[model samples]
Target: MSPIEAPTIEPVSPERLAEASVWIAKLHGDARGRAIEEGLRRWLQAHPENARAFELATEVWDDSEQLRSVVPFRPLRHVEHRPRWGAMATALACMLALVIVGVFWLQNVGVVATAVGEQRQLVLEDGTRVFLNTDTRIVVKYDKEARRVELRRGEALFNVAKRHDWPFIVTAGDRQVKALGTSFVVRKDVERLAVTLVEGSVLVSPVLPTLPEQIQPTIDAPGSIEQTPVTTALEARKGAGEFKLAAGQRLTFDAGAVTKLDTPSIEKTTAWRRGQVILDDTPLQAAVIEMNRYNEAKLIVADPDAAALPINGLFQAGDSAHFANAVAQAYGLVVIERGNEIVLSGKPIQ
Candidate 1:
């Protein structure tokens, strides 16, 4: 009789192979204990294929020191029998896949940020120019389907190179502005989001559920209607009360409602791009807030009466001293410079 043939072994899966690579990396680290050994033993005993996958991964890691060198494995501390192996393995597998695909890992995502009183311009891979305003941060992600930018904080102006097939979308403060071949500015503040269209058109929609209630329009708000005529004016497809904006239009969204301002001054709204801040009769408090965005030295209106004073003029961005002096001269407010703060107070009654 022929010798009894051993049971056929199934091939290991790529996922398992990746997981094994992670375990091998961990074992090479400083962590060692009976719990770790027992956990690994259980994993190996769970399936015959697990052992084979681990062996293959180990052999590959041993054979190529260069491949092993690519993985930046951190020293995990005091981790008992948890399934953290899956996460580590997935990371290792991804690194190896990046090597095999001839793609640098960092190339997938890009970040642009500006410090206070600073601005920058970036030309994206799609020939779109993005101008980041002071104290702004943006994450750019380009994929096969679309070019997406997340306005994580502050403001940015996007000059999109039209690609109808690859729509450019900007997400800011619970709102998404989808555009094609348009120039638009997205500003995200602590309590509100503003989108202004310079040219072309864009569809503005709320990112509900994903966004918290603090920033979204509530049902009880007067302007949270079922529809708006602005959508029709822009000739855009509407859904979920999404507002549409054409060139020279601006949409401001707060917790109360979304309001559209028609024919807004494109130059004044976008003056920061030219290192200027143009305020057309803006309230003093509001102007101070705007000025603080561009400068490390802050402007504080200690007097509520002084805070409500109207401000109108063009001032260079980041020129807090000049702005404070101008405000003092214009409104009879006293400007007191203390440390890094410029305090505006009502003048003494004469």
Candidate 2:
């Protein structure tokens, strides 16, 4: 049976919806983002449905950005179940993407992304600066009311222009970070998340009413597997937490409350920012981990004390082989590579 001529979701005003979509794209990728953009350019020169779809897609993108921007992100109540910067689930926003699109079907769209190892820099309407790191994706939300952003995966640094009433927030994992005129870093990793402060102060903590156990994810993109929801490690953020970082301090913690550790050193802490790792008498194992960031594979310390052998110098992030060579020469150790793992010892393993 022919798909009935569905009650078409009447296209909203071109300018208004288009404007709204722009805001949406700022926070989330839209139908017309890459696909639609290419499609639309082709449509304008070729046929009309392409143009119609592109136009409708445009409205969706613009409004999504606009609506969120208008609503603005706020610091969620301290619940502690929030994921840190490096370890947020990549599936949250994708689920909602289809919902937003379906609801506004025959609607508009907006936004952009960077590939793995790619960095993106954006300037918000209020002149705030956002820097994205490796495989990072973000959409800027702007509206008549407020400004906000949705971070999907990877890491980002926010240099915000603080406004007292309209606070700026970064949403990652299950937590919300409120920065009212500050600079901070948020990193999301597989097993952990972190929020680091570079300048000004940020209120880094958990969100209330935690993410329930047994998360059943929705597939938003093709060929992507949904994430299985996991429970927070600890109860509502407990322990002595709440980091008010100064110029060169950073805070890390799971759901068990904030753990403030002095950044090893300026050189060590900010190494990724400069694309360089300068270790100063750090353990071989620790150094190995840092070097592995530039590549894939687990660099294992064969001997417990093998890593205890401290060596220091500058190395690139994720350059495991070169770093291994450097480690061998500097600390009199042998390197062994097996599959995706690297091992260290005084003599190469046979």
Please identify model 2 stretches exceeding 4 Å from their true place. Answer: 1-116, 135-146, 150-153, 162-165, 209-243, 255-258, 261-267, 336-350
Instruction: Please tell me which predicted candidate would have the highest lDDT against the true structure.
Output: 1
Q: Considering every candidate listed, which one attains the maximal TM-score?
A: 1
List model 2 lDDT by residue over 71-101, tens digit each: 1011112232544422221222343233333
- Candidate 1, residue 241: the lDDT equals 52
TM-score, cand. 1:
0.60
Backbone atom clashes (below 3 Å) for every candidate: 0, 43
Can you list the residue pairs that collide in candidate 1?
none
Q: What lDDT would each prediction earn against the true structure?
A: 0.69, 0.53
